[model samples]
Target: MTKTTFTGQRHPAASTEAENSVNKVPTETTMNQGGDSSHLSFQLTSHKLNGKNYLEWAQSVRLAIDGRGKLGHLTGETKKPEPGDPKMNAWRSENSMVIAWLLNSMEAAIGKPYLFLPTARDVWEAVRETYSDVENASQIFELKIKLWKVRQGERGVTIYYNEMVSLWQELDQCYNDEWECPKDSVKAMKKEENERVYLFLAGLNQEFDELRSRILGKNPLPTLRETFSEIRREETRRNVMLKLDSNLEGKNIDSSALVTAKNENDKKKKPWCDLCKKYWHTRETCWKIHGKPPNWKKKGADNRGSQAFQSSSEESGLQPSLEVPPFTKEQLELLHKLLQSQLQTSKLDPSTPTCSFSQTGQGLGEDDWQC
Candidate 1:
């Protein structure tokens, strides 16, 4: 009798076990390779990664994994195949891609030593062990101290809020996991949120004191997100009001300045007359008796005497009347009849001179009479 080694096709009783193994391995291989084509396209960058940013680095790595549809690999839900398994090549390819991306996404100083890691899980675990443990106690302490001392001086509301948010995030990644007991998961989260609200309020500028008090005065304190929103709105409103006020004040100042300048210009253009005690015309250009005659070119004692005489005559209403031309016929007849009637009634002769002016100043001399 010739004995042959067991082959699944020739030995019908062993066919079931062999067939099951064949089906399982190819299914695993197909699943892993199906998404590998897309995963190779997304590359990770080391933008914010430092030795101290393990949490941020880990978060970025997860996002990359999720983008590539490889979250199962990151969570360790998809483990490496055993030796000689048909799916082993596909499993190794998937894990190696993850590991490569992880190394590329880290700072060169922090990643160079870990570049030779055999799997993604190994690299991730090593980083966590280094940066997420007692080894980072000092760094965590520093971050906490900074958070405590942070202030909103000179910074805008959004900028200060963002900085505080960054501090809170880094602090959480450093100590939240280690200190928060697993038993108080939900309660611890709530407490941590409240603490964040208080910390944010405490670091705000004094200008925000009233708003901060309003938030704290609530029976149930507000969330950080809500607090930030309210503060941003208030800051915007304040800025708008200040700008409007400044613009209005600027317009008012400009108007007042223009009025003042016009008044000054008017004063400069007007000429004061000292002789007449009036404005708009100087003494040299005045037309009143107190002013020099415009046509009087010569200056001498005669001109001075004429000016004085003109001024005195004007003051005394003694200006000479116009010369009498030949009398009209009606005026001469009336005067002749008046003379004949006067000759008949009066005793004095017409040829004799008579004084018509009153003696108001001094006794008149014989030659001072006028007819």
Candidate 2:
């Protein structure tokens, strides 16, 4: 018998001839075949049990995928995407999974058409299904609720709920029925208290954040050793409190009201006024304080007169006379003469010529005068 070759390997002569003689074709193994060969045909719109309508299901997913990109190319024989597409950030559903799952949940619940926000269970499950790490995905839902509360404006919530049961009950009742929530009787008072607390907290947080940013923004954040010395230098007197040691306890004076004003004297560049202990530079620049010190006028420059500087500031819409450079004795004398001249000019009759003009005319005879 003559030998036959199969992919360069010799096969039994009789077996190879019988297989190759009739068909002249190659048969591929199950591993080499493409796709889910178990059930070759399928419809995307229908879930396994036909739980969803074909058109609507397809449209929803299409819309969702389209928001991020064209997911149409995903199909059999294709490799599964290794990671999420970055472009989907713009197409984010915000709470798409939550809303979709809610639609299904409500459809089953009331067993009819009903307008309902997604319940917590629906949101949780949807996120769980979408992301392998469910814990991280829950953050998106929380943020969605926050956005919803903000959009509701005056009806926004201030309380946090541990479970969905109470929250959903409130939301469902509010949406479905006419129910009035009791307004906090002490709201205005609470608002003022809250504002003070918030401001204090915010300022404290800002101080820490500024320090944190300065420290952490470097290529490598500072170590304890690098930061400790500077931190001590930055401390205020009260930072290391001079409390009567609680060990020798007496009355604990409330230090709550001990607030200090920032000294912005350098910003105003004004002279310090010991009397007011406020720095708008000096009493002369302290428009809000009113009733100046006896020598306030003596201290300020009379160069252009108060009104002249004040008018200039008004023209520029600036506060009157910002911290001006201090005048020496000679400069002060020159300023005095300058002010007197301005005042005299302001008071002069329109018909009269200036003193310089009148003097020049008197000194020069008509024969000596020329244009």
Candidate 3:
């Protein structure tokens, strides 16, 4: 009267429902242990395959898959197990996970057709066959033209060098030739490297003209890497020099502007005299009100006029006249008083006859008074 469980052994007349439930249990368990849903949903690369970027996209996919230790799934190194093998369910789960990663890393349009591929290898091979252009002569030719025309125009040395190196690597993939002899291969590589060095030098901006000439003048040309490093160092030096020159120029402009402003302010601050209608002296110091002093004529004459007078006197053999001091204020007052007293005396004495002052300060006649 004991009941039998299907887990122990499969009966010869096992029902379809019992077989399906048994198969589902192990498949679900294997999927849970071998491939998490998160792992299947993860995007392999930031760049999606869009037919044109097949080489770059393939490289990314390979790196991502290899990192996950499931590269053998795509490479066919992990062969499929026969039915009923203990590892068959785990292998299936992992393969399905790899397929999901591939689809997730492709463009929607490019990935849709490959969605139902039977295996990871099938999907990878199919995509590669459709997009790989390794043998396209026209593409190689276009790349060569672009490499020759690439210039450092307004770009940093690092960025320009990176761009050139990427192009060179792509070209290398297209022309991967194998030499039978090791020595011949090394010689060919040297020749190719020399050409690359020339191309790199030729593509630099005019500012590196002198450095490029020096690099080219060497009997044994430097390697491409050595040439790049040398040029990069030169670029760094030039940038520093330019920055210093700019700073010096700015300082010079600031100093000159300050000097000009100070001069203008000094001119504006000078005293103005209303009486003399001149600058640098006020009405209190006007020469007209103070009367002329000793050497006044010489002081009034400019340097050029004085020099001309001196030269003329030397030529004529005449000594320059000595400067005479003007009359003092006390003497001027005394002279005025004497003139007034003399006029009064003349009025008082009719016999003396009225003495008249001369307007020109000279005696009009022998009886006239002169001052």
Clashes of each: 0, 1, 0
Model 2 agreement with the true structure over 305-339: per-residue lDDT tens digits: 44454665667777664554454556655755775
- The residue-level lDDT of candidate 2 at 8 comes to 17
Locate the minimum summed-lDDT window of 10 residues in model 1.
Answer: 3-12
Which regions of candidate 3 are displaced past 4 Å?
1-39, 75-93, 112-119, 218-220, 273-278, 282-371
* Candidate 1 lDDT over residue span 281-302, tens digit each: 8877777855566577553333
TM-score list, all predictions:
0.60, 0.13, 0.62
Q: Pick the candidate with the highest lDDT.
A: 3
Give candidate 2's TM-score: 0.13
Give residue 74's lDDT in candidate 1 (0 to 100): 66
In model 2, which range of ten residues has the least summed lDDT?
357-366
After superposition, which runs of candidate 1 have C-alpha atoms over 4 Å from their true positions? 1-42, 48-53, 82-86, 107-112, 133-135, 176-183, 273-371
Error at 43, model 3, angstroms: 2.9
